[model samples]
Target: MAGTDKQQDMLAEGPAIILVEPQLGENIGMVARAMANFGLGELRLVSPRDGWPNEKARAAASRADHVIDAAVMFDDTAGAIADLNFVYATTARPRDNFKPVRGPVEAAGELRTRFAAGQKTGILFGRERWGLTNEEVALADEIVTFPVNPAFASLNIAQAVLLMSYEWMKTGDQAVRPVESRPEPAAKQHVESLVAYLDRVLDERGYFRTEAKKPKMIENLRTLVTRPGFTVEELAVLRGVLTSLEKFSPRKPRGSGAPDAG
Candidate 1:
């Protein structure tokens, strides 16, 4: 496993690999090792069961200290993914949901496309025992499900992460395309804010109608809003539109009197 090539620069730029509620420090360390093997550096841990700065994880990293050392921990999945522009939830079993699904190869290709466009992306790996919950899966833009044997589909957490990391690396420079300059995609937080604002307005308007259905309504609204991948400027324009609709009044007609000299 000693394949250090100091002469060549390490490939450290790629999608963030997010582990949601990982249970073991050793597993986290193995994940870091896998990430390092494929040049993925950004590691996000959402509520690691064993807590951060675990010595066991460091020991398991096998000299991949950079990935382990730079890892970030978040209180919850939403916070962990708030800064990402796009995300893919890695799950094995079907969740009986409507989210678009892609295999590892196709997912990797899409990752390359988004990365080339200057959009930050990440992939979410669920708990080791069970995969991502439906609510957590809903936060992601799409689903990434591996095409494993039906009889034995479960994959170890590190193995799941490694498959994605490896596919991302395998896609490499060949998958990247020429990208045109454009406004950066709005981060998840921006979308969340917009959704929250809309939800508040809708609640004031009694748009939910029924208390029991409110949660589903909000979830659907979030899914709808997040699917478009709005750019920063687009989001600002949307906010302006919403504000004007809520509060704008007809202004006095521009005065016919000569305007102040420039």
Candidate 2:
């Protein structure tokens, strides 16, 4: 779909995304697309290998014209992040330095706290092949690492940017929480109604045939029905099922349908 003027106005206000010596124009474009997906606006390129104004990158970015149009170029990593007050470097391997290491979620939370307090922040991503040098990782205040399979932890440049961006977006968004959208649990009356209906059906079917076990069986049946905490709709469905069985079944003994012995 074509981007609209209104959509362009909804630019994200968060950390910059810095690419240190990224190799491919296609990767740059995909990075732009990922940034756009998560509401990240600022994109800084530190000496991209394929050079600047790459048509391949622009074409690959697809509908994220705003990100491609506003991308800034820098000669080195230091130049790329010089303006930011806080910076994070993303690396899969543990560096020798004692810098604070955080997963993407924790890093995003820190970034959100800082950004909201009027501090500029950004994250540094390394090259496509060898990743950042020790010196580059040292430049950032903290390190961000992905919790991936140790045997194969390599991630593409765009994929890395997408992960960080998604987490950053989620930091301030309560919508991602499962409990936020969950329907309220069914009321006590609804559950009681279901339990009563079940008890009546089982009692008529001689489920509690033994006089001594009748009270215990009823209690167990009520416990089983109430344990699930069924919603109103679920209770209605259960009641409909019980009514159907009662309407269709013969009033004879439970084994009346069995074959007669010779």
Candidate number achieving the greatest TM-score relative to the actual structure: 1
Native RMSD of candidate 2 (Å): 23.3
TM-score of 1: 0.85
- Residue pairs in candidate 1 whose N, alpha carbon or C atoms collide under 3 angstroms: none
Candidate 1 lDDT over residue span 12-131, tens digit each: 488999999999999999999999898888999999997899999999999999888889999998899999999999999656557788999999998988887778999999999987
The lDDT for every candidate, in the order shown, is 0.83, 0.76
Mark the regions of model 1 whose C-alpha exceeds 4 Å error after superposition. Answer: 1-12, 94-97, 173-175, 181-183, 247-262
Q: 43 in model 2: Cα distance from truth in Å?
A: 0.3
Cα miss at 70, model 1 (Å)?
0.7
- Candidate 1, residue 130: lDDT: 89
Over the full model, what C-alpha lDDT does candidate 2 score relative to the true structure? Answer: 0.76
